[model samples]
Target: MSTPLWIFDTTLRDGTQGEGISLTAEDKVKIALKLDAMGVHYIEGGNPGSNSKDIEFFRRVRELNLNAKLTAFGSTRRKNSVCEHDVNLKHLIESGARAATLVGKSWDFHVHTALQTTLEENLAMINESLAYVKNSGMEALFDAEHFFDGFKANPEYALAALSKAKEAGAAWIVLCDTNGGTLPGEIGEIVSRVVREIDAPIGIHTHNDCELAVANTLAAVAAGARQIQGTINGYGERCGNANLCSIIPTLQLKMGYGCVSDEQLKSLTGVARYVSEIANVHMPVNQPYVGNAAFAHKGGIHVSAIMKDSKTYEHIEPHLVGNKQRVLVSELAGQSNILSKAQEMGLDVNPENMKSREVIDRIKELEHQGYQFEGADASLELLLRDAYGGTAQAFIVDSFKIMVERTGGAMVTEAIVKLSVAGEQVYTVAEGNGPVNALDNALRKALVQYYPGIRDIHLSDYKVRVLDEKDTTAAKVRVLIESTNFKDTWSTVGVSSNVIEASWEALIDSIRYALLGMDKDEYVPEFVGGTHGLSNH
Candidate 1:
């Protein structure tokens, strides 16, 4: 029999402590649903006493029929105040959460200096808070803030604090690496001792200041901690909290712990990406398990070996976590890379085909000219389809023009695009805040009528990199545009000396890819224009 390790996610609470991470009530609800669907044991909704947003989140979350228990976070009562009289404690109880977590100072230094209170008084605060929550018929968790440091400084005081919480009915005694400076060896040793002393279940919450949050968490689990507290994508204050993305797979696949169901584990990658998308954060390509580059093979030698035996390179199957193996095309790629990539894209092509060699040579030549296809798989697919003569031209740009002018102390930009779709000429003009926006507006206005599916496509991200910084304005710039139809996302790239030209090239490729994947029967013209009118030119 395997010991069950509970996954306690604090993404909604501790995660928002990360710099630039803010979540609306709706966003929090959406993430909670995703976490519940992924079989997380507990979801710390938010600190109910912090702000109106979090208070509202607790209220809104009650309406959700989630499988995971919702936990409300708060601090222990003030120095001399009774737990019943504390407003923070009142809010936590009124939040209607299934569980309540109260963080109290455990370190003797913090008790004496930070709180300016006696160690005995701090112990009373932890005990009284947990006792009150437990008496109210709710599960009480005591978070001993800075436990590792506290234990090292005064093991007597730290163990006394845990003893107090347990005696006062804390269901779980959580040790927090608040400063995030503890190593795995120290965590394992300390956790082993704490488990021997504390009678209740143990939990671990760690920060990533030393980049050892995951390591320390696993150490605690190895030493008998039953619960792991962390956030999705490691979003939290300072260096962030432990990443459940890495922790979940490690616990289930590597350690043989039944942290989540097999089906829930498979949704890990999609859920990670979903949370990042809702947080408006760029998903790191190299993130472990669920990242774009996690199982991506780029080198020729690596691709050759992986094609023959994936076990030679891959640690685990990508599909286990809802991620697919990617074969990237680049200057470093060989003929085998091309064939493998083609096969992954569902293209039937022989390795000996001359067209495969031509495509490989063309990719290398284009890369030499500053076009990198590694991050632009959509563009590479379009190139291959065109070379194979299997893709039909979506539209042809007859001409386009952009105008920038200053009017009444304000800069105004407009674009005129003339294009032919299915032998029909359509000319459109639109104004925007910038040249790229103007071009995007004009192009979408023209194509939305012919292909209503294009209306669903929108630019999610745009990035520009200069090939030669020394050349300044004359340098060739590479523009990468990420477009999405709310269901799928793809990246396309373009390079040119002129910034506008490069942006336009990437934008055209984006539109072409969006239109190429649409079913003709799904085209329904729905006008979505108002403030700035779309005009026929």
Candidate 2:
């Protein structure tokens, strides 16, 4: 039988520490509900006693009948203070949480320097805080703050702190790599020693300043930690905390741990994206497990090989993690790639009769001009349709004007748009926070008269990436626009030195493809029965 490891999510407590991210009580409650639905084992909510928002979050969550246990988090009582009277400790009880976590200094340096107390005083704090919570009928967990570095500096003292928490009735003694400076090798050795010395279950909380947060956390787990503490998307101070998104799949699929089942496994992608959305952060394209590029293949040889056997180019099946493998067609696409992508877009491609090389060359030419089709399959579909002479003009842009003005320290932008469809002219105007948004609104309004379904097509994602960061004001920026309707979602791209122009181009193509899809109801067939290619049906 495989080992069972529990996940402790700290997105509310630690994730909000990221720069420029501040979640209100309502926001935390919404995310907590989603996490509960995702089947997280525990949620380490923020220090309820530290702020009114967190106190309210706990008060509200108590009435939720949540699936996951809510753990109130804070530091241990101050030196020489009684845990019953310590405001931090009292706050935990009043916060209406069933579980509580208190972190105390384990490093000798932190004990003496940061807390301005003796080592014995810190140990007393750790002991009394846990005992008080345990006596109060709450599940108590002790965070051995900076335990990894502390173990390196003073192993005996740090282990003694764990022992104290154990005797005081901590459910788990969590070792925290607070500075995120510990390596996997060091963590393994330290955890091995600590696990042998303590009778309580061990946990690990890690940060990512050195980008090894996940690695070190996993190492500790392998060495005997039964609980893994991290945030959903790794939101926290500095480089952030260990990402539960990566840890969960790795434990279940790679490490042979039987914590989550196949049903819960399928929620991986949605969980990652849902967290990022509630956090109001753009999803990182390259994030592991659920990233858009995680299962995407682009190179010709790679795509061809993947078509023959997915294992040739993929670490694991995309479906295993609730994701699908994608074949990106651009300058890198070959004949097989063109056929594969065409099939994905529900188009047919006969290699012998089709202009496969011509399409590849055109894709390359457009790529050289900074137009990327990799993330924009809708744009690729339109290009293929145009190449096949199957596309028709939905609407034509005649002229557009943008105006910007500053009012009360706020920038007000407006757009005026004119269009000609089948020789008939139409014009519209709109106001927005930016010129590009104004143009998009105005264009969509004018077209809604001709195509009412345009109302269903809404922009879901917008990205502006600078081609060269060194070219400050004049750097070319690439814009990616993702559009969605009730049926499906598709992306389109554009590039220009002007950010607004690039956004406008992508936005226009996104809408065009949305309209184009409405006209084509026939499903394109895939050409299969090849022995040399990967499986596709």
Candidate 3:
């Protein structure tokens, strides 16, 4: 039988210590509920005494009645301070948490230099503080800060700290690699020794300074640690804490240790995304287990094999983690890449026919011309449809113009747009902070009356890349625009010698893609002009 293992999530506590991460009282409560639904064993919430905001979060979570034990975090009673009257301890008890985890100095160097206290006094603090919490009816967990480093330096003193915590009725002895500098081998050896000597259950906590937090945690588990302390998506101070996203799947699927149910495991991707969304952090596309590119196959050979047997290039089924395999078409693509990508986009193209052959040729030619379709799916869709002569000619852009001037020592920009829609000409003019803004405003103002969906479309991001530097100021540029209709976001790219023209191409594609998903009743006009701009061929 598999040994019983517990997952303790500390995302709300340590995760917030990450440089760009911050959560409100309501945010932490929401994350706690999500963890409970995901079947984690415990959630190490923030310290209510240090941050007043945490007090409100604990109060709010009480009404939630979460299944996972809510644990409060704090430092062991201040040096030479009484446990009963410790303000931090009082806040922890009043927070109404089910568990208390107090971190104490386990390294003799920290006891002398950092805390300015003797090793014996530090042991007394850990014992008394944990004893106070246990007596207050809260399960006490002692976090031995710097235990691995301390054990390496002075093995006897570190063992004495764990013994003190065990004697004080600590339900779990958590060995923490506080500095995040310990390697996996050291973690495994130290945890294995600690597990043999400590009477209480053992837990492992690590940081990612060396990018080995996950590896170190797994090593500890192999060494007989029953509890694993980590954060979702690896959010924490410095390089971050151990990533529960990678650890959970490895433990349950590969290591034969069950942490969550099979069904709950499928929600791993969703949970990582949800916390990322709430934290307003940009989820790395290459993050293991739950990233966009985790299972994506870009190489033609890889994609072809994945089509026959996904096991060829993938370690596990993508659906197991709620992510789907993506086939990307690029200059390095083959017939299989084109056909797979086209079919995925709902285009009526097949591998048996010569249609994918033509698409592949055109894609390579375009890539040679500084047009990349890998990251711009919206533009790629339009290009593919154009090849089949199925692209909808929604409207025609006859011409546009921009003017910039300085009046009263302030720069002003204006744009004029002329369009042909349904055999009728529509003209509009607008002013903006810049030429791109003016053009965007003018174009949208002209089309919003015909396509109400245009009103819903908003440009979220716009980036421009210089394709050549030898020409200096007269270099070809590529523009990538990310637009969203509040429901879905898509990206389009355009390349040209002029930045304005490149921006126009991407801006038009953004509008065209937005209208494609809108009401079909939108006016599709018969226009008199070229079907697309110079860059569209």
Candidate 4:
């Protein structure tokens, strides 16, 4: 049996505080429901009194029977006002949540500089706020804002503030490294002292300014903190908060803590990607657990050894986190890697036909052109599928033209596509926010007439990168688009000097891949005798 640590997610609250993510109330609820399904124990919805969207989130959460407890967050009542009389208190009550969280000044400097209040007055406000929420029949949690700095600056006052929250009935007292400048050793010592002093369970909230948010969080956890508060993808003000996506896996697989079931942990990467999609944020490729590069092995020696025995290269099995090990074929990939990836994808290597060299040449050429197959295994699978004649094309793009213009320097891109499906010609025009979107929409619209199932598949992601950022004026760009049907998600890539041309190519391939899935009958036999079967090798 493994010890369970509570996961307190604040993606809806702190994550939205990032530069450009402001979801509507409906989007918030949708994300909340997804988070609940992912099995987080608690959700810090938002500060209800702060804005209409947050207030609406509380109202909507009240109407939901969410698996995770909804926690309404706000600050302690202002000085000179009783918690019961504070309008913020009334707003907290109106949230209709079963739990409440209140942040209070823990640093003496903040009490004097920010609040313009005496230390004694700040203590009173903290105690009064926690007591009022407890008396109102709600579970209360205290966020000791700037706690580390406060503890270091004035240990007695910080300890006193935490003691007040405990006396006032806060279930958990969270120590916040608000400025994100605290060292891990300092956090471990402080958390150890506070845990020893306070009877209540301790929680930790850390920011990433110094790039130690995850490190500090782990240190605090080791020091008796039972709850971890963070946002997915490390999103927040400034650099961001500790990323729960990274934290959860480290806790479960590496640290021997069980924050979630193995089944849920296996789908962790999928959940991380899913949330990023809803938030409309680009998934960071280098993110620890769920990132594309997490389990990707690029070297020939590493790939060969991993294929023989995964433990040779992998710290933990990739499947444990719903991610699979990938052999990245590039200029660096040797015959061993080409063989390994080909075998994994159920490709027929045919050494006699010298397919390895041909495949390696193609991969190198594609790499030179800025096509990264590492993040798009589905696209690679499709490539392998086509190379072996596993799946025949249902349609092919004959020609396409796209026009893009900006009104007042704002961009508007449109696509005109022509294709032949089953020897029948079709043409369509569509407009979109960008060239890729427009091309994708037009292609899908044209294909739907012959294949109505295309409607079931939708584009889930579109990523474009300038190949040479330093030479932007003369740079080429690459585009990768991920699409999903009811069952699986596949990524396809395109590259060209022109962004529009790259997007168009990727869009056409994306629709073609989706259509390929519909033609499973065509590839079932070819794969049966392929590398996935031992006899083929």
Candidate 5:
């Protein structure tokens, strides 16, 4: 039987300490419920004694019926203060939490400098806090703040702190890499020694200052720690806490620890994305296991190998974490890469077909001209459809014009677009706050009449990148636009020397893609496979 490794998520508490991250009382409860659904062992709600928001969060979270135990976090009692009288400890007890975790000074330096107390007083604080919580009928855990540094400074004092907490009935005595500078080797050794000296189960709480929080966490686990404390997506102060999104999979799949059930493990990617969405942080494309680029293949050789054998390049199956493998078509892609991409898109194409070769050649030529298709799946799909003679001409663009003027200290932009929808010409004009907005408004006005579903299509995000910095204003710019029709989101790309022209190309592709799905008799339009190529303009 595999050893059980408990997952303690501090996203609501430690995670919110990250820059630009703030969660409301409602957000905390919602995330706690999600973590519970994922079978997380513990959810550190927040420091109930710190602020009114956190106090309210603790009160509101009681409304939730979660599977995971909500742990209230606080610091130990002040020097020479009664544990029952301490406000922080009193708040923890009244927070209605089943578990309480207290952070106390373990480092002798912190005891002297930060706490301005003797080492023996720090130990007393740890013991009194844990004993008080246990006597109050709540599970108690003690976090030895700065444990690694404390051990290195004075091993005797640190061990005395853990021994005191253990004797006082701490269910788990956690070692914290508070400064986050310790390496994995050092952590493994120190944790092993601490576990040997203490009777209680050991837990690991790590930060990522040296970019080794996850590594050090696993190291501690290997050295006998069963509980791992981290935040979702590694959100925390400074470099951040250990990322449970990365650590959980590593523990279960790689290290053979039973952290969560198979069903719960699959929800890792969704939970990571959901937390990022709620926090208003951009989901990192390169985050391991849960990122968009985690299982994406862009290189020609890599794509070809992945087609033959996924294990050739990928370490683990993408679906294991609820992420899908993506084959990116780009300048580096070869003929095999194109064929594999086409097959993945459910398109019927032969590798030996001359049209396929022509498509590959065209892609190479276009990529040489600074038009990248890797990030523009919609545009690549349209190009492939045209090559396979499956092009659906929902609308034909006749012309478009954009004008900008400043009047009364305000800038106004207007766009006029003319298009032929099913051989009937439609002209529309619209005003907007910017040139792109005006063009988008005008284009939608022209198309929404012919295709009512087009009204559902909206631009979610737009990004522009310059290919050359030396040319400055004259440099070719690539515009990537993300569009959604309330059902699915797709990305399209356009490149040109003129920013407006680039935006226009992307906008047209976006509208056309939306119209294509509607023309398919309610079937969702996906990237279909075909000859991979770009047409010469």
Candidate 6:
């Protein structure tokens, strides 16, 4: 590895700018602690000048012990205003942050158009604001907004902006690709010129407007920028900022640069997930490095090759990022896909066993009829076990009925479910806001008395997809139910012409899977594929 790369995380400040991302002050603190534990060098918390919430966050964060340099973000002192009287800079000092990052206009066009101030005055703003922050005993950093575009339009003026920051005792002169339009080659060239023309330490910040934020950040680093600034999962305004999730691993493992310790690097996946969860944003399944499907293999040929030599289809050992290889079973699956999935689940299905072949055929047949097992591990596991007669007959679901009344007075929906648990017939009735919920309640009411564990399983998310929209109302519906036992989560799937029936099928598998736990030692030779007739289900 080469020289250490300073990681400046702006997730708290910039990440919240992305649409649908709203983090509370508590959420910011939680994310900050995660970043601190993950060994980031600096964290640009938030702009305390504009948002009152950020002021509260700064006050709360002061009580916590953290290792990362916590910096408050704000623009330079207002144009033509005294730096000492600037409200933005005043808030930065009062916020109790250890450092302050001041963003100043660099592009000549923005100086004349946006700020409506003379270019010289903008330079003064950059200089005085940073100087005041530094004189206040806080580390001062300069963000040259639109530096790439400024350098393209007026190279001298852009370099002049950075010179003012250097003269103000700025600790890091960060070049910002604010518009995010600069390509990799141009970013490298401009950053290289800035590095040579200025005698200050260089940093890089970029957006994803053109989907090159990560690329531009890497370009700047390649051209002698020592610090990289970005956000977790690339959450920011417009297309978002450069993603630290991808940049960290690329720098540490692939580019021969030391960003985080190997142990800290392992926590990168967890950090990304935790931040996404708190931000209430869903990570794209194909997101690089940290997504659930990043290392998943679905093709039969790929699974076959990987089973023999994992390097054949994998880039790196997934465990390095705290993830694991996943084999997805579908119509595209081969015998190898079945065997690989079985191995992943710790099932002892032999590669040469005909039962394994039977399971593959069954999955393909079901998938042909519009069943998707990639997201329904519980249902697929049940199928695999049933083929080997390893699945125990826990309960038998019999007659079920739903009644919805919308005549005039008050709308009402009810469900009646009849099932047998250990030879004891159970009939239960329940009311709900909808048909599916009523059926879920009725079914759970019937089984909870016999199997108390059923009470622990609760549905987290429910999704239904139409297999053939051309069929319209007659189309087959695929229902996916995500359930949790408060300890572990699992997904199950069912498909039928009736949406309610599909939901019931998924609900049944969810309950059965939870009851069976998927850790059975018995693997009987006799098959019981259709043993659970689930009469009238």
Best by TM-score: 1
TM-score of each: 0.93, 0.87, 0.84, 0.89, 0.88, 0.87
- Across residues 399-423, which tens digit of lDDT does each residue of candidate 4 receive? 7888989889889888998877777
> What are the per-residue Cα lDDT tens digits for candidate 3 across 1-537?
766689999999999999989999999988888889888999988997887788889888899988899999998988887988799999988889999999998999999999999998999999999999999999999999999999999999999999999999999999999899999999888888887888789999999999999999999999988899999999999999999999999998889897988888888887887787678776676788887678777799998898788899988887787666777678988987877777665678756778778878888887887887777777776666666554556678888999999999999999999998766899999999998899999989998888776887778778899888898889988898877653445678888898888888888887776776673355322222321342332
Q: Which regions of candidate 3 fall more than 4 Å away from where they truly are?
A: 1-4, 385-462, 481-491, 500-504, 507-537
Which TM-score value belongs to model 4?
0.89
Query: Residue-wise lDDT of candidate 6 within 1-537, one digit each (tens)?
Result: 278999999999998999998888889988999999999999888998777678788989998878899999999988878978878789998888898899999999999999999999999999989999999999999999999999999999999999999999999999999999999999999988888889999999999999999999998999999999999999999999999999999887888999988899988888887787678676676888887788889898999999999999888888787667778888888888888877776677767768777777778788888888888877877676655544455566678899999867878999998777677888999999999899889988887776676777778778999999999999999999887654455678988999987888888778777767632444222111222222233
Best by lDDT: 1
RMSD of each: 4.6, 6.0, 4.2, 4.8, 3.8, 3.9
Residue range 1-537, candidate 1, lDDT tens digits? 667999999999999999989999999999999999999999999889889999999999998878998999999999988987899989999998999999999899999999999988999999998999999988999999999999999999999999999999998999999999999999999999999978889999999999999999999999999999999999999999999999999988989888998899999998998888888887788999988789988999999999999998999999888888888999888988888887775677977669888888888888888998899877777676555554444566778999999999999999999888777999999999999999999999998887787777788899999999999889999999988765566788888899898888788778766666774344311111110111121
Stretches > 4 Å off in candidate 6:
389-461, 482-490, 507-537
TM-score rank order: 1, 4, 5, 6, 2, 3
Tens digit of per-residue lDDT, candidate 2, span 1-537: 888888899999999989867898998998888778777888888998888899888988888999788999988888877877798888888777878999888899999889998888888988988999889888999998999899899989999999999999999899999999999999998899888888889999999999999999889989999999999878899999999889998998899886567778877777777677667676677788888788888888988898789999888787887777788998768888887777676665778975888888888887886788888877777677656554445566778899999999999999998887656888899998788789889988888887788887777788888888899999998898887673455788877898887887778778777776676664221111110111121
lDDT of 6 at 128: 88
TM-score quality measure for candidate 1: 0.93
How many clashing residue pairs are found in candidate 2? 6
Residue-wise C-alpha lDDT for candidate 5, range 439-466, written one tens digit per residue: 9999888877766777777787889999
- Model 4: lowest-lDDT 10 consecutive positions: 528-537
lDDT of 5 at 497: 92
